[model samples]
Target: MSDSNTSDFTNPSSFILQGIPGLEEAHVWISIPFCTMYVIALLGNFTILFIVKREPSLHEPMYYFLCMLASTDLILSTSILPKTLSIFWFNYREIDFSACLTQMFFIHCFIAIESGIFTAMALDRYVAICYPLRHSTILTDPVVAKIGLAVVLRSGVLALPTPFLARRWPYCRTNIISHTHCEHIAVVKLACADTRLSSYYGLSVVFLVTGVDVFFITMSYAQILRAVFSLPTKEARIKTFGTCGSHLGAILAFYIPYLFSFLTHRFGHNVPLRFHILLGSVYLLVPPTLNPVIYGVRTRQIRDRLLRLLTQKGT
Candidate 1:
């Protein structure tokens, strides 16, 4: 570890994208756009939450999941964003080891929760599309609440080991994280001690937890499609697909960058340092900016409610 990196870790940071080579200089380019994205994302998602909370009709399993997701995105975005922007704009790169660990913990946890909510949402779509007649009964308040609680608990528990594991490592020289935030990989890699085992463990958790959740979400949607095709009427088919349009859009927007990041992390050194970093930044920024839009554009009920909320408030 270099002396500079070591010193940076001691006092930690306030609002900077620490640890990356040349990031202090590159902030003028990426940081500006990143800050803008954060503002728009925060505004858009909170609008959804406010509208959903104000209106009663919008309350349902699907919207509930949307609310969960919006809330998750808010938490996820705020977790690293301010500090990341601070690093860029304020030139702050110091972060306490404990603070960095907490950041990594939630970064992974909320993302995992997003995955879980998405899976539950797929199941909701399946119930609504495949068993329209039984949707009401199969997706009752109790069931939905159970799923929500389960999602939160599952994501939270999976991340419980992260801080513990991170703390056990003998931190070496520098604490300069190579990315904008305290991302799990970057934080672990900064450890002067051997991080191979810890890195593998974290990666395994990602695959087993988030990856598996995505696989099941895909499967649920596939089953939904098959059931849709079974409908004897064309109108039913359109309705079935329409019901999932927003969800599909949100899923694609959220997961594509995630998939890219996962892949690049697996094989990106062959590319450029900028490549992986850029992809991860996009992954963090894009979903929060786009999620509310997807819901507003596709889900008519939420759209109408949000539109009314905006109009009434002259926003």
Candidate 2:
């Protein structure tokens, strides 16, 4: 190993994050839009959470799941964007090794939890549409609490290994991460040691959480489609589809960019670097920014409450 890499293992102090390599000159400009997105994400999700909390009528399973989603989005965005903006705006790029691992852990853990929540939402929708009469009994408050707890614990436990494994790897190279955040692969690639097992583990985690969530969500939607088409009237079908619109939008927003980014990372070696970086940024930013908008526009309850709250504040 080179002397610098050897020293990295012996006395690693900090890792420098490269935000967007060629756009260092434009970081000030970049921060404007990124900061805007972060603000929108925060306000939008917290509004959703507030609406859920204040509205007693929205104490159903579907809205409860929505609350979980909003909370997850808020935490996820908060975890990354502040540090990201610090890097972009102030060139605050160095992160302590242990702190980097902790950030990476929360990032992956929340993502996994969000994916699990998506699956739970799917199941909730399936029961609501397929077995309407039993929906209340099936997804009672206690049950929702249990599901929420399980989702949190599952992701927390599963993602624990990521930072631990990365921490153990001897980073025998320049401690420069190629992205804004300390992503598992981004940090692990800095290590000179063989990362095959860790890399595979990362892939496995992705497939395990996202893959399973997508599979179940698809199944739920398929069953929903079948049930919708079986409705007695076209109006009934339209109404049913309308109710699912917000969720479908949220799912597409979350998964499409995510899957695209994942593909580009593994297979898009020839693709432009800007595309890879921007896609990852979009994956992180878009869902949080758009989820509340989709929910607000499509769900009458949230929209009405939000408008009332704004009106009250204005008055």
Best by lDDT: 2
Per-candidate TM equals: 0.91, 0.95
lDDT per residue, candidate 2, 1-315, as tens digits?
222333546336678888887888988898888889889999999888988999899989999999999999998988889988999888998888888999999988998888888899889989989999999999999999999999999899989999989988776677777788888888888887888988999899999899888999999999999999999999999998788888889999999989989999999999877667767776888888999989999999899988898999999
Candidate 1 per-residue lDDT, tens place, 132-197, comes to: 899889999899999999988988888878877777765555555677777777666656677787
Candidate 2 segments whose C-alpha is farther than 4 A from its true place = 1-8
Top-TM-score candidate index: 2
Tell me the lDDT of model 2 at 5.
Answer: 30
Residue 51, model 2: lDDT of 89
Candidate 1 error regions (>4 Å): 1-20
Give the per-residue Cα lDDT of candidate 1 at 56: 87
Over the full model, what C-alpha lDDT does candidate 2 score relative to the true structure? 0.87
